[model samples]
Target: MAVPRQSEAQEYIEKQRIMELFDNITAQLVFHRPDNPKTFMIDYVEKLKESRTTQLDFPCLFDESNIESVFGMLDPTKKGFITSEQYKESTQTLGCDNVDPSPAGSDMDMITQDTFRREVKTGLKKASATFEQV
Candidate 1:
């Protein structure tokens, strides 16, 4: 069976739902660290900036720019990788509870650049899917 087109009311409701989700994400980020706090980690601050940019409608799509931004957040040392702990912490902070802390065949302590991107993209795709279903 073909899916029916969304009505104007349905579209408006979807928009409202998206707005609410972004608002909550913003509040969570701020609660974790206020704007321009000196003691706040630069990584967290950058993530906050990304979220704010997304909320401001800067193409929330997981494109090259967004992917690179998130990668930089995870690889702040510029060492080309992040620890599994960092991965877990970052995902959890962003309300992504579906990420497995320990995926098979990977060292649970050290996450390589490739692994980081793959896992993050997976999470983003899952989040998008869930949001679309709203």
Candidate 2:
């Protein structure tokens, strides 16, 4: 059966959802860096095919301290936040080639500490749900 065409709004929402998924997947790959990349990739793909709702166990707890440390690094001035330029510069200074310098999520200009913490928690939740315990 042919599916009905999606409206522009629907398309935009779908794109946003896909982007968020990719962001979550990227976080998992980068932060976790599974011991066996090939096996992890194969398993991850297979799991996705089987069910996007698949739940996987994560060995480590997503601690707030880790999030705070990262945010502190990004906000060296202790101004309680980091602008896009600062984020870009700091990441570059740290030699993070894969990370995007721009502020992530809905905020395109700056990232407050609270926002950063929330995002980190959300990403950790996504990673926990999407990845398997090894």
Candidate 3:
């Protein structure tokens, strides 16, 4: 038996990332819980449209102070660097899941705060670009 191909509607939804958009909107609604859901959705979609037209600064979505705080939490001893696994976990926690967790250069097991920040920002920008393309 052969697998059936997706219907045109399903293909369109996948191609245009409609489900992802809807999921994001739904998540926002649940998180914010505005009194006027209709108005909130309208504004949310409008902002999304505007963002697509403008140059959004993806890195700004995560504040520098907050990133530093996360890094500090992961490196409680005030160590200048964290293990690669910790770096990967922290970046994923920060919503940069696409980032490569390996440390740069010959140091295969450690990531400094500066390196983490740079990689996270780069990953965010790349993710934003991919989303916009969709």
Q: Best candidate, lDDT-wise?
A: 3
Q: Which ten residues in a row have the lowest lDDT in candidate 2?
A: 52-61
RMSD after CA superposition, every candidate: 11.1, 9.3, 4.8
Which lDDT tens digits does candidate 2 get at residues 1-134? 66656786677656445554465556557887999876865665566545445444332234779768888877778987777666555444432434433445326566778766665554555444433423
Query: TM-score of each candidate?
Result: 0.46, 0.39, 0.69
Error of 1 at 77 (Å): 2.9
| lDDT against true structure, model 1 | 0.58
Best by TM-score: 3
TM-score of 2: 0.39
Task: Quantify how close model 3 is to the true structure by its C-alpha RMSD in Å.
Answer: 4.8
Overall lDDT per candidate, in order of appearance: 0.58, 0.57, 0.69
Ranking of all predicted structures according to TM-score, beginning with the best and ending with the worst: 3, 1, 2
For model 2, name the residue pairs that clash. none
Tell me which of candidates 1 and 3 scores higher on TM-score: 3
Colliding residue pairs in candidate 1:
none
The per-candidate count of clashes, in order, stands at 0, 0, 0
**Model 2, position 49: C-alpha lDDT score:** 45
